[model samples]
Target: MSIELGVLVAIAGLVISYLAYQLTHIKEVKTDSQENAEVKAELGYIRRGVDDIKIDLRANEKQISQMGERITRVEESTKQAHRRIDQLKGGDQ
Candidate 1:
């Protein structure tokens, strides 16, 4: 009878150990899932920021091109004015 009691106690200890292992595993899985979700949210925010920066860069490029064209037109007008002034001075001579 003592041997039977010892065997039963051993079986109960094994069952308790298995339950504890399962609970620990479940907790670890839940923690990992939460962390992954947070990481995904942060990545989405970063992607949106990058897209905004790209739009701003495109607008700046367009402005720079417009400025360059305006400068070119001004330079051409200055050359034409200089030629006109030279012709007027020669006619007076």
Candidate 2:
């Protein structure tokens, strides 16, 4: 009878110890408000970064458009110079 009781007590002790360990190691979930706040901050940061990128893209696009216009003007001037050279050489009109 004594040995039986000792065995039961040992088993109970082990179960209690396991439960205590689990309680200590359990992780708590973040509250919805905290999660939302973090998400909102991240989104705001990303939006600002995206806005900056859009500004840079617009500036680059304007520069590219100006360069294209300049190239067209240069081509027209080149054509005119060629016409003058051909007239000097007595080539076709």
Candidate 3:
């Protein structure tokens, strides 16, 4: 009878240890899943920011091209005015 009791106690102890191990594994898996979700969310936010920057850069490039054209037009007008002034001066002399 005493041997039977000892065997039962040992079996119960093994079952308890197995349950504890499973519970710990479940907790670790949940923690890892939560961490992975947070990482993915952060990456999504960064991707949005990069997309916004790209849009801004495109707008800036367009504005710069427009300004360059305006400057070229102004330079051509100035050269024409200078040539007219030189022609008038030569006529007066």
Candidate 4:
């Protein structure tokens, strides 16, 4: 009977240990899940911010190109005016 009693106690101890391990594991998993959700939310916000920046960059690039074209036109107009002035002065000579 003592041997049987010892065996029962050992079994109960093992079961209790297993239950404790399971409880700790469950708590860790739940914490990890919550953290994962928060990370995903933050990542989504970052993604949207990056996308907005990209759009702004594209708009800036378009404005720069338009400015470059206007500058080119101004330069061409100046060159034409200089040539006309030179022709007029040569004719007077």
Candidate 5:
């Protein structure tokens, strides 16, 4: 009867140990899920920052195009002025 009692105690200890291990494993899974959520949130912020940069870059490109057009118009006006000046000089001669 003593030997049988000892065997029962040993079996109960093993079952308790297994349950404890399973509980710890569940806690680790929860922690991993939290870490995954944090990583996903960080990625979302980075995506938004990249999108903002793209918008700013497009705006700068448009402004540069407008400046180029203004410069072209100024050059055309200068050329016309020079031609008028040359005509006046020819009449005086």
Candidate 6:
């Protein structure tokens, strides 16, 4: 009878210790407000970055459009110069 009681006490002690260890190691859960705040902060940063990219993209597009206009002017000038050269050659001939 004495040994049986000792065995039961030891088992109870082990179970209590395991529960204590689990409680100590349990992870804390974040509240919804905290989670939402963090998500909103991250989203704000991403939104700002996207806006910056859009500004840069618009500037790049404008520059590319200006370059195309310049190229068209240059081509017209080159064609005129070629025609003048051909006239000079015919006169020389």
* Winner by TM-score: 3
The C-alpha TM-scores of every prediction are: 0.86, 0.61, 0.88, 0.85, 0.83, 0.66
RMSD of each: 1.6, 6.4, 1.3, 1.6, 1.7, 5.8
Superposed model 4: Cα runs more than 4 Å off: none
Q: How many residue pairs clash in each candidate?
A: 0, 0, 0, 0, 0, 0
Q: Write down the worst ten-residue block by lDDT for model 3.
A: 81-90
lDDT of 3 by residue, 1-93 (tens): 999999999999999999999999999999999999999999999999999999999999999999999999999999999999999999999
Cα RMSD (Å) between model 2 and the true structure?
6.4
What lDDT score is found at residue 52 in candidate 5?
100
Per-residue lDDT, model 4, residue 23, is: 100
Candidate 3 steric clashes:
0
Model 6 lDDT at residue 63: 100
Q: Is candidate 4 or candidate 5 better by TM-score?
A: 4
Q: lDDT tens digits, residues 1-93, model 1?
A: 999999999999999999999999999999999999999999999999999999999999999999999999999999999999999999999
Give the Å error, residue 60, model 6: 0.9
Instruction: Go through the candidates in order and give each one's C-alpha lDDT.
Output: 1.00, 0.91, 1.00, 1.00, 1.00, 0.92
The better candidate by TM-score, 1 or 5, is 1
Off by over 4 Å in 1: none
- TM-score attained by model 6: 0.66
User: How big is the RMSD of model 3?
Assistant: 1.3
Question: Could you give the candidate ranking by TM-score, starting with the highest?
Answer: 3, 1, 4, 5, 6, 2
**TM value for model 1:** 0.86
Minimal lDDT window, size 10, model 1: 81-90
Candidate 5 lDDT at 92 equals 100
lDDT of 4: 1.00
